[model samples]
Target chain A: MDLLGINPVLLIASLMVSATPILLAAIGETVVEKSGVLNLGVEGMMIVGAVVGFITAVNTENPAIGFVTAAIAGALLSTIFATLVLYLKSNQVATGLGLTLVGLGISALLGKPYEGIKSPTLQSLDIPILSDIPIFGRMLFSHDAMVYVSILIVGLVWYTLKYTRVGLVLRAVGENHDAAHALGYKVIRIRFLAIMFGGACSGLGGAYISLVRVPQWTEGMTAGAGWIALAIVVFASWKPWRTLIGAYLFGGITVLQLNLQAAGVAIPVEYLSMSPFLITIAVLVIISARGNQGAPASLGRPFHASN
Target chain B: MIHFEKRLNPSRITTVVTPIIAVILTMIAGGIMFAALGKPPLEAIRIIFWDPLFDPNFASYSRPQLLVKAGPLILIAIGLSIGFKAGIWNIGAEGQYILGAVFGAAVALAAYPADSVLLFPAMVVAGAFGGWLWAMIPAILRTKFNTNEILVSLMLVYVAESILASVAQGLLKNPEGYGFPGSRNLQQYPSAFNAEVIANSGMHWGVISAFIAVIFAYVMMTRHIRGFEVRLMGEAPKAARFSGVSTTRLVVFCLGISGALAGLAGMFEVSGPSGQITIDFNSGYGFTAIIVAFLGRLHPIGILLAGLLMALTYIGGELAQLMLGLPGASIQLFQGMLLLFLLATDIFTNYRIRIGGSN
Candidate 1:
């Protein structure tokens, strides 16, 4: 009973940690979708990021370096996706699925030797006076660096999409790539960049799992977090702040399930394990029912420049 | 500088040759991967591509296994291709597959130890219906709520996995088998078993169903008005609409047929090779069927050949693991590479690449 006890403050704080990876990935995906590129390979990128980040941190002993390398790895993989979809004009849905297959296979192959290996733990930072603010401090000011970074990224992405020229260009590209091209904006270049950024964020999220959350290497460690991130992007209605809410809500569900399991709740373990996916999808259905009017008009549509 | 010039008519020669070219490229790349892992590239490629068919010692065993492996793949891919050609993506056939197995197995489990000729047939019907019902979740959602079917279907796979695990450990656990988390082996139950039809050839109800599906799909795509409507819808949705094709109905039909086929594959697999409801009965035939569907160029005959080739890889990959100690992940990477190269080279089918030319 004592071991399974759930403290409200601790539960809320842990929710932030659980949410960070999806938050980072969803925020990045929102940017990519805004640019009219729907990269369904977030799972692939995240797993690749997880394995590469784990190996890098294992060799360098620095989680920061691991995260950066993971981002680079994710971006590099996304380039393959970009080339296939953008240049070759392959089906976006099929290409994205292919990318995921490639990522899972390659990551499993790469992480084979690193199985059962452990890396240095990521330490949480404490704010000076804020750390003394009781429940609020522990809940808000006591997370690892990535937690703060994820929230900061949401803010940065929201500001960029809402108040900047580049943001307008991205939104314009997503709304109608042909019209954006007519306006003389480089549609392909903008989309390519956005896809790369999304890949990087997904990588960082994967790295957070391997280097911070579990701090160990395992094949397919990201599980379906990537898929959850995709659902969250839709649940957020393509909005950054809503993405934050969706991620936390999902993260909260995940953490709460584990706590329930520990508390020896009579619910079947399988049902609890499946709740996050079911809940996210249910929300997606409800949100889309109200109408997907916010979807970028050109979402999932390939772009071509006429001569 | 290079430019891709769109062709007014896709090259017939390229359509036939591109898949071959992509396959050769996969071989070369896969050979390099083997060499990197310190195995003889030639021997590895020979074992994967050639030995499965010709090796006297392994041929008899591998030959039957090929049919066993390809049966489900072909069955599922046939269903998937129908929807794919109609532009309705049922990305979660895997979920339908799992539910079908559960539903079919439940029927058999309920009649355990009974010697009735009707048990297996009942299981088959239950399996197909189970799959169709599972598929309806996405279909209804897409038509009614206008939600993205791809994401929804894929998400349901995870949920289905959970249900599979629950059933294996709970409702389906064998009562008389020392508390093991699996049902009574269908193989031991003659009434409920999907027994081999012809002695020692691995021919079963599943393989027969696959052959039927292939022929049905071929005729549907080539000789039916519905097939033309499907192709028109995929190539030009607005045109399809103008031609009086009901988009909603087409979506439902595509999803329903695919789901039923996927379910049939699951039922056959569970009753035949798998023999019981276990925690990990699904070996990802559903996901792998997607690759098979595309590799076949979404053509019925092409899928048949593709299914055999993929089945060969599975057998050969296992052989390589035993003989050369190559990790299993390498084979998965090889499969993914095939799809990547296929997509990359498909460009040549519809466009000519101009070198150093300004369009």
Candidate 2:
């Protein structure tokens, strides 16, 4: 099939659609980590959101509501996590793993009835001038609302963290929890809200997978996107804008390999699929090589009230 | 204002009872999940806990099968327990498992139709090396680059699965088997087969290795200075550092053991019950072993019993599907519920629950 002899452009366009899910999820997780709580159950929550979003989209025939509803479902599920880590002070890592197992199981069970059904499509949007650009028009500018929202989210998050008073308080709480508590701030409440917001963003990301990327329901279809998002958070050094760059970089690698397979490279197709993960690891190593200063000072450390 | 505080000196009785309470709560939550799924809670409960050991029809087949399933699980969990104990998370045992199978099977296939006693040992070594090498990817990154091992290891599983799919379809595809995508049956090859040493009891080399691993783990965790260091690292990283435990060394040790044991589990599985490397060879044994490691309260004896109990669910769940026309996925969900509720109810391990209202 010849589409104006620009196959790579088409491939890049498709990659953007695929990357949207991870982009949204990673951005949210970046904020969550910045706030000093490490939630490993992103994969599980995304799966649950996928099922809920698909069922809602199929039932109502409105993809927008379906996406919002999925985000709500994810936030509600994350409240369970927040209750444990924030209120009960459970280990975030262990609790997050448990959440993933439970979320995967629940989604599998719920997704059973809706198995083999198609989700409502999310069509591309066209702007007045940007969509009409010569070569790089539709590929970059025209996308589903979720993609643009994720971009906007990146900008907004960056701005907030860099300039806002609330960001100052949140970062303060993350960098030094006991001092923040002594300064008359609500550490638990701030974390709860941050976790919930992150959950919502992640939920929307899963909704994008069901409603756009795959456009069908399959168990474990979120694949390892949640884990990728987590790594990308670290890859970005816990910054929202860098998270976008890392996500799209991953997305580009992910898309390029598939294109290689389509182009019938001499290498095996299996290795093509594996390329994204290998590259992600390579990137992680490069970013992490900066050593002790890369990670957040408070990542994975539980804050007891007294401490 | 009323406040809740953990007692500095809790009784040993409370320690014993908390896990027991966790068990009871897990069962109750599990039963509720089964009920919601339109299955009888009693039947589901019976099938999960009791039917595997007592039911006449399934008991005979499942009794021997228990050791078969438990062997790999115990071996993998024993390795994982060490990492967890040392606060080094290696979540990609599934990837390690697949690499092991692929590496081991590559050898057996390379020597196609050649009968020799050394073939099996060579494959075992290759398989263990494969898993250990895969695990080292994360270990090296974590120690050298300060990368998160949890993400690095977990993501590698997908890559391993792709390798499995590609190899099973391409290089290892049986020539005489009419275009099927799987290796030759190693069980038929006497030199490579891991046959049961004790007939009718599923007591193979794998089971023996599992028992040996448990014994060694028990000794290492209790008697050795390394064990003390591991416990210290997990509970108090600063204290562990000050106490002369090298973080890098612990990372290597924890990840290396887990990878080697997981590799052994994979090697045994390929040579024994599985017989060949096929597409989707891993049935989440690596992931399920995580639950086993935790459910056993991270102890050697606890892991042994947890392995048996978890294995019972696999056998009984299969029986339930065969007899009751239920989907196999449901059983996975049910088992997952056990872990979810277990974690949810374990809030009492450190903190005492205080009533919201007081006089």
**Top lDDT hit:** 1
- TM per candidate comes to 0.98, 0.95
Q: Tell me the tens digit of each residue's lDDT in model 2 across B167-200.
A: 8999888777699889889898888888999898
What would the per-residue lDDT of candidate 2 be over residues A1-307, giving only the tens digit for each residue? 2323437777778888878899888988877887889999898889888989999999999999889998998888888888878766766877888778878888887888888888888888887799899768877888887889889988998999889998888888888888889999998899898888888888889989998988999999998999999888888888888888888888888877776766677888898888888888888888778763545567778777753
Worst 10 residues of 1 chain B by lDDT: B350-359
What's every prediction's RMSD, in angstroms? 1.4, 2.3
Off by over 4 Å in 2: A1-6, A292-294, B1-3, B7-11, B352-359
Cα deviation of A174, candidate 2, in Å = 1.4
Interface RMSD of each: 0.9, 2.4
Worst 10 residues of 1 chain A by lDDT: A1-10
Off by over 4 Å in 1: A1-4
